[model samples]
Target chain A: MYGWIWRRLPGNAWVRAVISLVLILAVVYVLFQYVFPWAEPLLPFGDVTVDGASAGAGAGREEGAAR
Target chain B: MPVRLVIRTFSELCITVGAVIVLFVVYVLYWTGVKAADASDGEIHRLQDQWSRGRIELPAPGATASAAPPDATQEPQKSQAPQATRGAPTAPTTRSAPAASAGTEPARRPARSTAPAARPPAYRDGKPFAVMYVPRFGRAWDWPVLEGTGVNTLKKGLGHYPGTAALGGRGNFAVAGHRRTYGDPFKDVPLLRPGDAVVLTDGASWFTYRVDRRAYRTVPTDIGVIDPVPEKSGFRVPGRYLTLTTCEPEWGSSHRLIVWARLEATRPVTDGKPPALRS
Candidate 1:
């Protein structure tokens, strides 16, 4: 998959490397700013309240309560 | 050539998945803390600015009117006053910030009634109304206490349970914070010792609560720990109390750790920092 992506690039190797770096950073930026925050509430690691169901089983119940 | 391509793609997919997982862990453990710190600091500054401008955000007066008993509803009721001063003249003199001590003192002292004061007006959810400091956490460790315990609220800093007692009021003023990420506001919750002070200010008065005991371990479902008279906390009657809850195991939320405190003293902000904070 990565080889195919590399071969389809429009630039020489150096330019492709720079473009890849920028693309990688943009992906990470999106992950941290949007994806992770949205997904964190779905995970059990951040749970703190006493009213919700325990982590792992029925995790969605806790997420709903938290909302 | 097709088989080679398939193998290469499979290897790249595996490597990409592994890298993403590691990055997610870094986001949870480190980046979140950085973002929370910035958010919490901004909240503290905003609260202080509001206080300096003489704007104290109280819960809507009528919202809790029916719930609060007649005696408890009074704004300056003795029930909500700080119980007593527990310090000697020779204060610890540990680390006092000059910037913090510059405010003018309130002209009148808090009344000494012993009744448990009613809960204060309901603060708006996600709005910061007070600042909390634990000397044990470090002289510089302080966080803005926002008014709800929801996930997004806790990310800003310590969150005050909505139905609990207000700061310096009778009943339990329970707070929850993250033990790992989101600035790890309660990371040292387990280290709190009996008599350690958990000080808080709502712009007008400084409330000093002394740790009643070391951390009490319990499951997250044990909501009784924040009761006005938490059974396991050694409190036999209703009184002013504080409960700090955080996830246990340091890095996971499998269980919970609780630290109970009793109101020790209430000082007007103009009087300077509270005694517990001096050390």
Candidate 2:
């Protein structure tokens, strides 16, 4: 399995730790790969959507938004 | 010396050294892409603010064309808004400073004529932001944070959470990344059930949000999915809320995945040690 390969093809634990850290961030990215198109409809949330872009006051800042 | 004493000393040293090294690496990476990253960070912060507020009065409509910032303390002039030239040109000029404030502080740009057509602005201010990393996936391509509209940035972090909304002027903080395949930042996003933690930090504050509930609402029909006020926003305003969204499997999941979280706690991010990031 890929897990076995990963464990075997390693340097010292420090290098592995860094690699593991990267792996973790990658998994976080996977969540992004989904439902963008669907969620987009809510984009303007409550605004004037003229030609696929948002226009208005609030400008649409949400939670985890500024992240 | 007692083994316990020696072990404790060693562990503390390791942690200190580890923290130093992490800080060092973060500094280097930041230096390499300070302008872009910090701009994006500012944009995020700005939108986060806008979620509750509005454009903080535009600075003298037309200041100038363009210039560079000189001091380390003064805010970077529209530091992150330059990227706006492409996306939303309606950006107001402002100043920002990086959170690092270490090494060469992120230089500030001089105020310029608010370009009519701005590019996708990055962060609205300079806030030390850590890259969102997820384990259990590939090593080469950890998701990168971008400066622009919230949805796009969320995509860089992962894919858009199917049901959540992006940070902007909206009430609820909705984020989306990816699920499975191609640098899956939110691969386990579906795994996040209610009561689980969805952490968001800007290398400044670690905001802990507890997942309360998750449901699949047809993206277009789900108005209250992100209800910022949580009371209405039903063609009316509402209290604030949080939503984590993304695709289901990978292939064909018409059903949008949504995970709801409530603000539980917040703590400032250490100098360079931003708490681990999650979607």
Candidate 3:
């Protein structure tokens, strides 16, 4: 997937390297601000309510509870 | 030459996948903390600004007389207010508590004779209502205490369990926070011992609660840990209490670490910072 994007870049190796860094940062920003949050609820860990309603308790996922 | 091209592309693909996985881990462990720190700090500053402007919202005066749980007494009075006004990012929406007991008003109405204050404060779902300080954590450990324990609510800071007592009120005032991430507000819950003070302020008064026991471990299913008189918390009578819960195993959520506390004292902000915080 990334190889295709790299091959299509209209620049020399040095210029492409800088563009690649910027592209990587943008992807990271999107993943952190939107994609991961939307995906977190679908996972079964990070629940702290002690209400017994949370599913999939054995995954051993770390972090705080959200449910 | 064709074989060489295929090998180069395959190697690049493998490296890209590996990088993505590593980035996800960083998101979970590091980036979340940074975001939570920013959110919680903003909440704290906003609360302080309100307090400075004399916009502190104390509990309703009628709440002072009747010592029943908040769900039974407070919900009925505000039942007319639409509980469905949720999802607005900034509005202070009413709580969406389980209204099964909205009826059956307590007969002790005469005890609650105090007139409603100029403006009765409604519990704003998913919004911050107080700031909590744990001296055991550090001289600077503080987090905003928001209402509701929903996934999004706890992301900002500690979440107050709905249906529990108001801060410094008569029943159990329970709050939950993440143990490992989202600023890890309760990261040192296990370190709390008897006599440690968990001080909280609602911009009006300082409430200091004294830890009553070492950290108690229980399953997430055990809801009794936050009861008016929590099981195994060593209290036999109904009284002002505080329950702080976080996930167990330091990293996983299979169980919970509980720290039970009792209200030690309360003082208005006019008196200055509580003694617990001076140290």
- Identify the leading candidate in terms of TM-score: 1
**Every model's TM-score:** 0.81, 0.36, 0.76
Candidate 1 lDDT tens digits, A1-60: 877788888789999998889989999999899988887767666667665453322223
Residue range with the least summed lDDT across 10 consecutive positions in model 1 chain B: B86-95
Q: Write the per-residue lDDT of candidate 1 for residues B1-279, one digit (tens) a residue.
A: 989988888999999989988988999889999999999999999987776554556532112212223332122233222212211111111122232233333222332345336555668878998899999999889999998777778889888877777887877888888888888888888899999999888765677889999999898788788777899999998788899988888877778899999887765553567767765
TM-score of chain A of 1: 0.69
For each candidate, the DockQ is 0.37, 0.03, 0.29
CAPRI verdict on model 3? acceptable
| Candidate 1's iRMSD | 5.7
**Candidate 2 residues A1-67, lDDT tens each?**
3345468758987888888788756643442233323343343322211112231211253323323
Q: Give me the TM-scores of chain B across the candidates.
A: 0.81, 0.41, 0.77
Q: What's the DockQ of model 1?
A: 0.37
**Which residue pairs clash within candidate 1?**
B59-B122, B104-B270, B105-B270
TM-score of chain A of 2: 0.39
